[model samples]
Target chain A: MTERPDQSPLTSPRSERVRKAAALTGRSARRKQGRFRVEGPQAVRSLLTHRADLALEVFLTVRARADHPELASLAAEAGAPLREVDEQILRAMVRDSGDGGGDQGGADASPGAAVGGALVSPQGAIALATFSAEDPAAALGAVRALPADGPVTVVVLHEVRDPGNVGTMIRTADAAGADLVLLTRTSADPYSPKAVRASVGSLFHLPVLTGAEIDALLPALAAADVTAAATSGYADSDLFDTALPARLAWILGNEAHGLDEATLAAAPLTVRIPLAGHAESLNVHTAATVCLFETLRRRRLEA
Target chain B: MTERPDQSPLTSPRSERVRKAAALTGRSARRKQGRFRVEGPQAVRSLLTHRADLALEVFLTVRARADHPELASLAAEAGAPLREVDEQILRAMVRDSGDGGGDQGGADASPGAAVGGALVSPQGAIALATFSAEDPAAALGAVRALPADGPVTVVVLHEVRDPGNVGTMIRTADAAGADLVLLTRTSADPYSPKAVRASVGSLFHLPVLTGAEIDALLPALAAADVTAAATSGYADSDLFDTALPARLAWILGNEAHGLDEATLAAAPLTVRIPLAGHAESLNVHTAATVCLFETLRRRRLEA
Candidate 1:
């Protein structure tokens, strides 16, 4: 295990690095700087476990580092510089990282609401990480380059604005062994703190392309011999009855509105997860998970 | 078709019914008053469609009723008195309902964040409904009375504290066609505005018993001949390989610590949803959905 270097606590709430990290909550800032912040212990741990080299800076409160040795150890192993900060600074960082949660500078940052302003920071670790701008064209090229011997699944989310749902979809896509998670321009930013928290650390597991134009991406995937299937409640084919191809992409739409006409028109087919009972519709996350796992189940059955 | 009567908007945020509706957010109030609120248009519609007789009061904002003539129509169909209130009253009702997303009372209550506080209410319709205290003994008795010829699945939530997760479970239970959704005393209040919003409309679709003592509930379920299976990541039997009973109760544990030793030990068998990916575990809601759908898949295969 690599030893963490000693560092003085950075007491300033307006430090440059902290500001930069906080800026990551906004998609514009992330795209502009090619950097994003992963908050809380789970997401930071995921960064260390899956893609540690991308981690540039790790910040923890003195108490957090003392209580969560794994945070310091992982940061050390990832070779990222770790700094102990006053808890107020961390809250400022979380507050600056907007996710609808207002900032409370008061000392009563209850232990229950731990991690400064960590959107969901029960574990109290946050990281500043770098990223290569995800090129939809490049992602399309990679998906097309697969060896073609087994099932290849990709998930496309169009106009899905909920960060938590987007994050959960990424995690489900990862668990279902997806090749990529593509988002249309209208979708929520995959790197948003609320989404990163909801993804349970699966954000770093695979390629997640944000801001792809649906019309262009669908055609590109189709050209690459991937069949596009949109999950819909009113679709003609039941998911179980649909003949999912070896190379496929599952397209999901906005939480409130299903896929728009243009996006729906782009899909080759639509598969509806059968609901025996009455729920006018499934949550976007639930529908995505069921669709992904259903494919997984089918592949296993065929095997 | 019953016509909605013309009435003045209930403008005062401090009105008696508004405060009572707000009080329904607290468990003590719900238990003492024998009533609870179901917010948003979808839940209100479901209440009218399924158990209209239990509806005590229907409250809607002037704009909500004007825009959604269906809200008034449904309440009238349910034979419940519909009162048009000021939007401020609705906001106050939503603000008083706590899920820790502090009240930002400005009027951007987009239809998507359904219950003004649900963070996902897309509609502004809210209703007050009556519920009988769920007797675990009677609920178990009812499950035992079901005809044994078809699959009857029940969901048992043990100490799952998050109201959102609890509500999602109820909705999934409805979609999965589960006969019952029972919660241990340690679980979050199922009727809390947050949970009710998450359940979508399923809170009214089926029986959701709160304050169930798992140690007693499981044996009683066992005695009723409904096999009790606890969901665990470490269980010996893979869910796919396990023998599911015709009448089954799926027990899920707390979001963080998981099932207590006593609950796990009492379960006739523990079945784990197999995860082939690197994510440490599924979200409690996700796990519950997967298990129920897997059961659905298995039954479909057998049929």
Candidate 2:
């Protein structure tokens, strides 16, 4: 295993090219170029442990290598090139600041700036990995083919457009032990850097299938005996009162517009989260978390 | 009510001055200059409806005035001056396109570019109102002094740091019927533009008290029969399993460090959101939602 390289400055033009390339790490770009960026020592280590089959490129700063010896050793053990760069360059490479650079009452820099600095602080560490895009049919087939002991819960995001929401949904679905996550065409890119950061590394662990047409998904879900439940603002039945199915697929919708007519028609039941206060609707991501957890809670009680 | 002026295209140097002034609308700046920026038609309408006792100013786009007759009438009713500008000029003034450009996403224009051929789609808008610096203690005291119809639930953000999270928390607190939101010195500004956007107009409706030094808050919470519950990874108690208090103050920490030791020590009970999957932790906003709703659920059951 080789020692992790020091990545303190953006001196190399090659490193700058790599950093610029990471901007296209969104799902659309990933589909075109077949690459994604992963950062932090823990994420890199996890990639080395599980996705060694995927081509890996490493960028690190001296501080990160020194702070995380295991990460350096793991990269060396996997025969991955660990290149070093300046912190400023690493900071520039990360796309969104997560916080949108809003003021924090002068207590500290905006959250986005803070998060960016934190990510850059470990010196600088990032990795590029190739992810095999799975066919929706093949993914559905694999879910159907799981053994009896496999996870039965499935999550469906229909027309959910926020990348942060998509990422959080995947993260929550993973936490709820859902077997699969499927996203429709109009949904946000699951692999977008924003979504990935929001997921807090859960994206790598979760089984995510994206870009599936809804018409094709309906039959596959039906074949698997997965009951579809859609969330609505006007539904009479509250989510807590519903009889959650043992094998279920939860369909979440867009922020402004809930589910479209087609998906609502496909769903066997529509559930609403009871709103007691004056706010009209929950944030899309919060709604997803609540829905996913409610399902997990129900299943646990039933078991 | 007279017709409101359209200020979409900010060609005039006077319009440029207004836009720049609005950008500096923080608590301190607002106090110093007695100005604040109000965006969107709905928010502007609400400000008028409230007839809040404060000096008001109006900046509107021609397209916005034509689209919303009521907005024009309302500005006239308030006797506020309205300025009209071309769509491009308005866009430029808003800095939507570039640093000083008004175009939002999808525009390649530099900041402060001329509005030569820009498309104008101003619906209806106005920036009105100058707010005096509110005394945080007085605002908080007023909220606390109100007669309790039911148990009080206060949200105390220790170092939330994220403007979006802070804004979302305030919105959620409003939705969940929390009595008040108390932000410590390290928390995000409650009135920042991004925060206001994320709150979805709840900022005006919810009572927010900011800059509460943590040391002073602990004693006040105790005296008010409020139990401070700290959320942390090290805590052995599950949040759902804990015996929640009738009057509670939820203290959430920064994304990384969580609640500091002093804050944790001050908290009467420490609770954790149990994670059975691969996620390291829930997003701070998501965690806040879970904690808030859990409290709501418990309170409802007891009632």
Candidate 3:
């Protein structure tokens, strides 16, 4: 974990390498480079811990390096190059990632700066990693092949537009022991900096397959013998009362217009999380957390 | 609901009133003016529906006015002024609010702006309203006075620094039929633009008391006969197995650091939301949703 004795720290924010790293913040740039940027100590730690193989490089401020001594060894063990930079360079790279530096009201324009409100709180560590591009069909098939003795749970995001919601749901899905997370074609790119930051490295913990179609996915679930259920505010089926199958796919929809009529109708069952207060609906991510936790709770009870 | 044909629409974005409205985005300006700005159709709709008396003025673009005709009548009925403006003017006001304009990748710098990356998706409608500055003690007393036969639920945010999380928890608490939502002194301002927007009008739907001290709050809950439960990942008590009381408060801590030792020690109960997957901990807001909903579910089950 010790710093290399021979090399000087990367100092220039405008260096070609720095600019290239900053470019990964964009979707097309990430697509072309075949990698995404992950920021903050927690996320970087998760990267080094779970998906070290995908880590291309790791960058840290002197302060961050001191704060997290083990990250260096983790990076070294993964064969990912570890570079130490000044705080300015780290901030420059994070700022350029387009993760919401603009909204820190003038007063918070400094220390209180919560980039993107709260989702992107950069804590002086960043990494670039390649997320494997998995074919949705093959991904579903792989999960289906898991031993039949254990339950197979999947969460399908259908055209969800918000990256934070998408990422938060991914984290929740991961926490709930879901086997895989699949996003439809129109959903937010899980590789987006906001989504990755929000995921807090869970993006590395599970297989996240994007660019899927519900049309193909529903049939795939059927073939895999996984029951599919859509979440809707208007649905009559209550989540608590419904007995879920051993292999289940929980389908969540867009933030604004929920699941389209066809998608909702296509699902074998529709369930609503009962709202006891005045809120018209739960945030998509919050609802997903409840649903995932409920599934876990039920499964544990049954066991 | 008809727009006054006699009066011309407010057209200048640089006008004093527009600038003053923009200033409310700052904490000091909001405190000084005794008002906070609420943006978008959903929040504005909630303001008009629930706290109409607190609304001073409503601003809408031509399209917004046309899209929501009921707002005009609602504002008029409340004796609040409604002013029409152009989309440029509305955008200018929103942009100046300092809600995450900088992080939108250059391409999304326009339509895809996602000001503050989804937390602040400013639509054309905006409202200036007064949130009653209730003393934390008085607010707790009021909730404690609610019918004794019915369960009283309260959510306490202890030094939670994220505005979006603060707002989202408030919304979830409201949705879970919580009697009150309280925040400690170091917590994010619930009136912050990002928080208000993330709350999606639930701030108007419920009473949100800020600047509370956990020291006083814990004792207050004890006096009020409401059980206080601090959420901790390390706690031995599983949230699912614990039987809650008729009146309860779910205490949540900061995002990076969980509850402090003093606060944790003072709470009557410490409960952990079981994580079935690899996520180290739930986002503070996500955890609150699980806690609040679980409470609601159990109460309903008992009924």
Candidate 4:
């Protein structure tokens, strides 16, 4: 596993590549470089397992290398350049200074960035990978591939800015057998480290088409006869009684501002998950989960 | 709302109240003081609404007080002192450094703490309140109070240590119409600021009994005719096919170790949530949400 000729420990915390890697925290940098990072062992390993071709490189600490021999070999097979760095550099690569205010609040969400008011500490390895620079048309093609008689589900995020929420929704979509996830241009970046980790690697498992507007995607949905439904608290349509078509998309909004009128107007049906609890609503991912799993349950019974 | 005599901008971040509020980030301090903090406007509002008598004081920024006049009024009506603090003090009361490592990982997840690797910046007000120190026997008493054929559900968290997960589980249980939530002795403190915030005010709505053991609760569960079902990935019983009774309890394990063998064996049945995704298992809260909602779905279908 330690067969690499450049086996010397990378001690400099300010290496150019490491700095570039750290820059992936910003949306502009990730967009400019077409790359995002995967932090921690589980996420990095998943990248190798599912999307090895896109994995550009792997960085590990000495202790991590010793602890995870198989990960090293797996990265080797993926042809990702594996380098060992000082643990301090690895932490620096992902750490964010906690004192944040104003515009900077939403920029990074990289691994170990303060999220949901908890420090998600760094684990083992880290990986840098190239992400699709533009929306993947192939994601729509996958949606079209759904059988006429078979049940198909798609989860849509409309201005849902929390990266963790975005990731968890994707993971939930995968578990519920959704064909893909759609994130509007204003939603959290799906490739951000926090979002990727929150998805628990489901970002790689499922087709995630980001930076697309509902208006632009409407034509593709029309062609495929996919029914787009927006989830709204104000909607009169209850989830339990709503008619879910064979090919359907469930769209949720931001933690605060919810779905914009344009997005809600685009969908013929606006449905609400009937939450009996006193809390105003379910967490975005939980609401998506309820919708996704309900679709699955109904499909199973119908089948 | 401006009726409090001590209304002043708390500038010194090291003041006694600010220090005490900061100490709430630790479980020991919360336990010893019999006080826990609620951060963000949603959580603080809910505390005022549901547990107003328990609320001892509220600290808010000038802007927060101006924006949430109703909350200030509620606090005033509850006889809870309202104090204005500089935004910095408010931030300090809940902000986590986001640089964390080792065993201290789960200790502090207060509002604006680094969570899932990103600092979730705080939204608004903070509240300090005393929680019932002892496990509420009335929670179990409520389960016993259920009508002979009425649906009664209890959510059991077995050593789930993440404050976020603990809070999310409580919220899920409430949303799924569970009678109450029980935390095993080893579980995270339900009253921690992070857990309370994650609950999004559902914490105030539900009865959460902490410092409990499954062994002692099993007998009561049995006597109440509540079926104890542990969620296990290896369990042969599929969640869909499992026998969910009118009265039941769903137990979920820790994020890392999962359920200990002793706890698993004590449960009359073990059921697994079916996952079609490539991911190995569901997140603790997502798993709990799935189980709780599925039970709700089935009961509704039967009715």
Highest lDDT model number: 3
State the lDDT at B266 in candidate 1: 85
Candidate 3 residue spans exceeding 4 A from truth = A1-11, A61-63, A95-124, B1-9, B97-122
Q: How does model 1 fare in lDDT?
A: 0.72
Clashes by residue pair, model 1: B111-B121, B111-B122, B112-B120, B112-B121, B112-B122, B113-B120, B113-B121, B114-B120, B114-B121, B114-B122
List DockQ for all candidates: 0.35, 0.25, 0.40, 0.36
C-alpha DockQ for predicted model 2: 0.25
> Which regions of candidate 2 deviate over 4 angstroms?
A1-11, A14-20, A26-29, A76-81, A84-123, A146-151, B1-17, B25-28, B45-55, B58-93, B96-123, B130-136, B146-149
lDDT against the true structure, each candidate: 0.72, 0.64, 0.76, 0.75
Deviation of model 3 at A48, angstroms: 2.2
Docking class of 1: acceptable
Ranking by DockQ: 3, 4, 1, 2
> Each prediction's TM-score against the native?
0.87, 0.82, 0.88, 0.85
Taking the candidates one at a time, how many backbone clashes does each contain? 10, 33, 1, 14
lDDT (Cα, 0-100) at A28 in candidate 4:
68
Q: Which candidate is the best by TM-score?
A: 3
lDDT of 4 by residue, B1-303 (tens): 111234555788777657666777776677777787888788888889988877888888889989888988999888998888788888787754332211133435344664433465556688888887646365466556655567888898888877777888788788888877888777877887667767888888867777666777787788888888888889998887776888888888887778889989999978988887777777777788888888887777777
TM-score of chain B of each: 0.85, 0.77, 0.88, 0.87
Local error of candidate 4 at B171, Å?
Answer: 1.9
Candidates 1 and 2, the one with greater TM-score: 1
How would you order the candidates by TM-score, starting with the best?
Answer: 3, 1, 4, 2
- Give lDDT tens digits, candidate 1, residues B1-303: 122333555767787656665666666667777777788787888988888987877888777788778878888888888876666677676554443322221111222333211244325678877776756676566666666667788899988877777888899888888888888777777776667777889988887776677767877787777888888878888777677888888898887788888888888878877675667778777888888888887777777
Docking class of 3: acceptable
Question: What TM-score, to 2 decimals, does candidate 1 have?
Answer: 0.87
